[model samples]
Structure formats: C-alpha cells, structure tokens
Target: MIRDLEDEILGCTRCSRLIDYIRKVAIEKKPKYRNYQYWGKPLPGFGDPNAWLLIVGLAPAAHGGNRTGRVFTGDMSGERVYRALYEIGLSSSPKSESRYDLVELKGVYLTNAVKCAPPKNKPNKEEIGSCSYFLKKEIESLPKLKVILTLGRIAFDTTTNILGIDGKFSHMAIYSTNRLTVVASYHPSQQNFVSGRLTWGNWISIFYKIKTLYTSHNA
Candidate 1:
C-alpha cells in the first residue's frame, strides 16, 4: 500500500509548474542555497505502518529532509523534534538517519503536506492546495489514526481542514470530533530555536500531551 502511494506521488503532476520552478531555482541558483541540496527529487514518508499517531509538517527543509529523502531527517528541525519524541518514548529509536537507519516509530507516522521541497522553504497557497489530494489519501490510508500532531499553524490548519474540522487555533488545546484528536504546536524551525521560543521542555510538553491523548483515547 505504501509503495503504491509512493508511486502515485512520484507520478503526480498536479503542480508541475511549481515543481519546475523549484527545480530550476535549485539547479540554477545553487550558489545561493548553500545549506540545502538541490537534487530535485520527490520526498518520501517515514514511520510506522499501523501508526495511530500522524505528524504533519509544512514542507521539506532544503538541506534537511530534501537532501536525505526522508521526512525530517538530516535537519536541525528534525533533530529537536525526533529527540523530543524519543524522550517521550514515542519513537522507537533516538537517531533518524535514512529510512533504513536504526530508527523506528511504533505507533507514529510522519509526513509533510507537500512532498517536494519548495523554494526558500515556503510553498505557495496554490502549491499547497494542489498537494492536498496526497495528504487526504495518506490520512485515509491510516485506519488507526487517533491523534494528529501538527508541527505548526499552517500544518495544523491544513490537516484539520482536510479532516473537515472547523475551529480556530489555540495553543495546547485538544480538538476532537470522532475522527481524531488534533494537537497543535509551533514548528521546530530555526527561528523558534534561535529565539528560544521552542525549548526542549516545551517540546516535551507537547509530546506528552500527544501521548496522553493517545493513551486516553485507547483506554
């Protein structure tokens, strides 16, 4: 099933123009984006198959997941996020290198809204909307998705909207509607790290809430 999904994603041309633009920028303007690799390849999902928890992020980081081909791997954002997951016992392994690395997510599945790496780490609204079908299909494939942890406001809003939920954003608030429990948190971006907005303790708190929600729902 996952393989089929990946194939479909690879063959997708919904936003071909946007992808072309990204590829051009990555290849032609390589000198400008020193932090990221401009390999111009599609992104892939990582994590457990029968995962009950789904994590949604904005898009692949240029030097991070985009280069590594696995979601949230080889990036600063991933480092902090994965570490928090490990500390909270959500992740099976502490380190997340490649998909075949010594990393495991027992009941967690990770994916991004956009599969391709966008320019300057920002995907336009049209591109995001075009990629919504894949996200919807990914959610549909997860039969045990009881909790969804959205890493940022954009991911939170996009995932919830895709799930057909209506509500405003409130930090640390759990939204439920028989389908799944939605939890929101600030994205573990460089800005958050530099400004000390998302500290280790704060990230752990968010993960604890997700674990608690999952436990309570299953109980």
Candidate 2:
C-alpha cells in the first residue's frame, strides 16, 4: 500500500509548471551529471512505515532530489541530515547519494512539503496547496508518528497549517500537544550552512532533542 502511494505520487502531474520544468532539466542534464539518468518526478517520503520521527522538509532541490528521485538525496542538505541521523543511530548510513545507496532509516521518515522540485527552490502558495494532499496522505500513513520535525520556516508553517496548530517557529522551538509534538529547526541548505546560520552543532542539537523525545515516548 505504501509503495502504491509512492507510485501515485511519482506519477502525479497536478502542477503543470513543475512537471514541465523538471522534465526540461532532466533532458538537459547538468554538465557534471550528463551521463546520469534523472528521475524527474515527484518524490515520495522514505523511511520506516511505523516511524516515530516524521521529518518535513521544504521541497526537493532542483538538481538534487529531482535527479535522484529520493527526497533529500544527492544534495549537501541531505548529507548534513543523513550524517546527523547516522551519528545518532537513526540511519544505517551517513550518506544518501541515491535511492539504491543502501542507506536505511531506522525510526525516522523524511518527506517534503512539495514533492516536486520547484523553480528557484520556491513553491508558490497555489503549488503548495496542490501538493498538500500528498503530505496529508503521507502523514496519515505513518501510524506511529509522534514527532514532526520540520526543517525551515516553510516546512514548519506548512505542517502546522495541516495539523491546525498555531506556534512560533524558531531554530529549537518545540510545540507539544496531547497527541504529538512539533519541533522546528533551520534547514541545512547551502545558504544556511555557508552563512553560518545553521552550523553542524545546531543541526545535531535538533536531532538530539528528537532522539530524546522519541526514546522517552517509546519507553
């Protein structure tokens, strides 16, 4: 059933603009990846089905996830995230270069607000609304989800809107309810990392907090 949902997401063409852009980029190919075949489709969330930690990212990077077909794969942001997860024993490997890289997530599921890679890494309000259905479906499928760790303000706001919650977004903010918890963190994008806004220590601190919450909750 999960795989079926993934297929559906991959085949989606709700956003015509995004579809055309992805296809064009895939056909042209980046100079460095000319020999590589691009996935060029909407990406689906990947991880343990019964995950306790649900990570929501803003969107797939144009040349990263769009080329690799896996959310957060083949990107610097992905490297940072996967490395942090591995250090904390949440993933089998510290890198996610491709879908077949054998990097396995333990208790965490990673997804995006918009499955398709958007132009300029920014999705319009309408595009985000169009993709909300998939996000909702993905969340519903995670039966054991306990913590929603949103990377960046866009992800945090989108997720909160979906959950019908109101909270301020900050690098280490945590908003808990009777049912689940929502944690906010700065995205590990090149802009953030290069600008020194989201350092390695800052990135790991978010996961450490999530790990603590997950362990205590499951215990």
Q: State which candidate has the highest TM-score.
A: 2
Write down the lDDT that model 2 would get. Answer: 0.88
Q: lDDT per model, in order?
A: 0.78, 0.88
lDDT: worst 10-residue window of model 2: 1-10
Task: Work out the TM-score per prediction.
Answer: 0.89, 0.96
For 1-219, candidate 2 gives per-residue lDDT tens digits of 556678899889999999998998899989999999998888898998878889999998888999998888989998898999899998999889898788889988999999989999989999999898888788788888899999999899888888888888998898877768999999999999999998898789888888888877778
> Which sections of candidate 2 miss by over 4 Å?
none
- Write the residue-wise lDDT of candidate 1 on 84-179 in tens digits: 878888787677876558787788888888888787777889888888888888888888889988888778878888988886766676788787
Query: Which residue pairs of candidate 1 clash?
Result: none
For residue 3, give model 2's deviation from the true position in Å.
2.7
213 Cα displacement, candidate 2 (Å)? 1.3
The candidate maximizing lDDT is 2
Question: What total of clashing residue pairs does each candidate reach?
Answer: 0, 0
